[model samples]
Target: MADIEVFVFAVEAELEAMDRERVGVHRRGRKPDLALRRRLVGLVWTLTFGGMQWRVAGWLSGIPFTTLHSAFARWARLGLWRRLGQRLALDWRLACGDEVLPSAVVVDSRSLRSAPSAWARGIDGGKLIKGVKALAVCDKHGSLLDLELYPANTDDRAGALPLLSRLAALGFQGDLLGDSGFKGAPFATAALAHDIHVSVSPGGTRDGCFLPSGIRWVVERLFAWLSRYRRLNIVYDRAPDLFAAHIWIAMISIISRRLVAQTHT
Candidate 1:
């Protein structure tokens, strides 16, 4: 069987369950094509693992580029990738003997240069890059919990509030650690209202030399993990939402591998 077929079979039950829930009473038109679904799922793996462009993946996978692109966008709109990431995160925590819900999380952002034609680009004064910024929140173990993308010139505090607010709505209550960019009375007050304590560490400098701090390093490492996926190393998608979906897909792949490894060991 093809690698995609094997993966689909492995997660067959989970996919079926999600399909049932997402499709709901609004069902119409013909039922989804299973063969096409397998191919699309395989294409996603190819994109995440090989960092192949859509056209390259289509040619390699023997699926039409237009079909693959349409399926991916439909799934992204249905929030399938985000749900998969969340489920895998819980599974990883369980495999590691930790609580499903994390007690604390680290937050950080990375600025990446966008394609010249990409929309919504901005300049990050700190990084000195003309592109966009990705703000992410990860648990203590570096599993991504949530992420948001905005123009690079957007203030760190401004970008962080929405993510923190989403976490709060999801019933998250814990301490949040971040770099100096997150320091401010306004941000702290906002976080406090969500029952999350906010702490900003001093710059990682000793005598003007750079060094890594302990707590905040987790989120930085999370960004490093994401960079391994070539597609995510830079912003190529014109739609910010599509870019965010790619982020979730990358995390889903990482966490799923770790979970499988833990089970065997």
Candidate 2:
């Protein structure tokens, strides 16, 4: 089998066993055509690693650019990629001792330049932070718990708590560390509900001095890992769904690699 086949197999098995909801079925059937799946995998991997345009991804995958783009949007909206992420996170939890809570969980967001079109406007038109942002949360052990993407214009504070709430539901409770942008009552309230303490890096304030900014480095490293895939390094997707899939798939890839690393070690 091809590498994509292997990836899909591993992902499919995990999702089949773990996901509470199923992806919407295509009229063609539940399992996508093998050729189509391979192409989708190739496109995602290429974007993940190459950071190329869909036209370029088309050339690489030998599928039409539009076809490649459509598949990505479809799968992303269906939450197939999110299911993969959840499975990877669960696998990491299983591999690590379930009783050992991480000493720290890091939170951060980074932006990427998105497609320039009418649709990419407003909250969709990623903000001024340089590009669209992928807000990520990860434990000190480098296991990613949750991630969210917003137009660069979206403030980090606006989207951080929802992911935190999801993480708390998933059993992540510990001191939460982030940059200065994350300091606020909403964050504090959410963290309090989960019994998690908040720490923020102080750029030049007394509160900054007390915040555990050093520990926030772990989340930065998590983003670094996700950025290793070229497609994610740039926001090349035309739709938010496609863009989110790139993030989700890159995350799954990172966790899968980590799982392998642990087994070897």
Q: Looking at model 2, report the run of 10 residues with the lowest lDDT sum.
A: 118-127
lDDT for model 1, on a 0 to 1 scale?
Answer: 0.79
User: For residue 65, what is the lDDT in candidate 1?
Assistant: 92
Segments in model 1 whose C-alpha atoms lie over 4 Å from true places:
1-13, 24-29, 206-210
RMSD of 1: 2.5
Displacement of the residue 182 alpha carbon in candidate 1, Å = 0.3
lDDT of 1 by residue, 61-92 (tens): 78899989887777678777777787787777
Off by over 4 Å in 2: 1-9, 12-22, 28-31, 98-104, 118-129, 203-214, 261-265
**Root-mean-square deviation per candidate:** 2.5, 4.5
Instruction: Say which candidate scores most in TM-score.
Output: 1
Compose the digit string of candidate 2's lDDT tens values, residues 164-260: 6787776767788887788988778877887788887753356433233465666666777776777776565566666777777777766776677
Cα lDDT of model 2 overall? 0.68
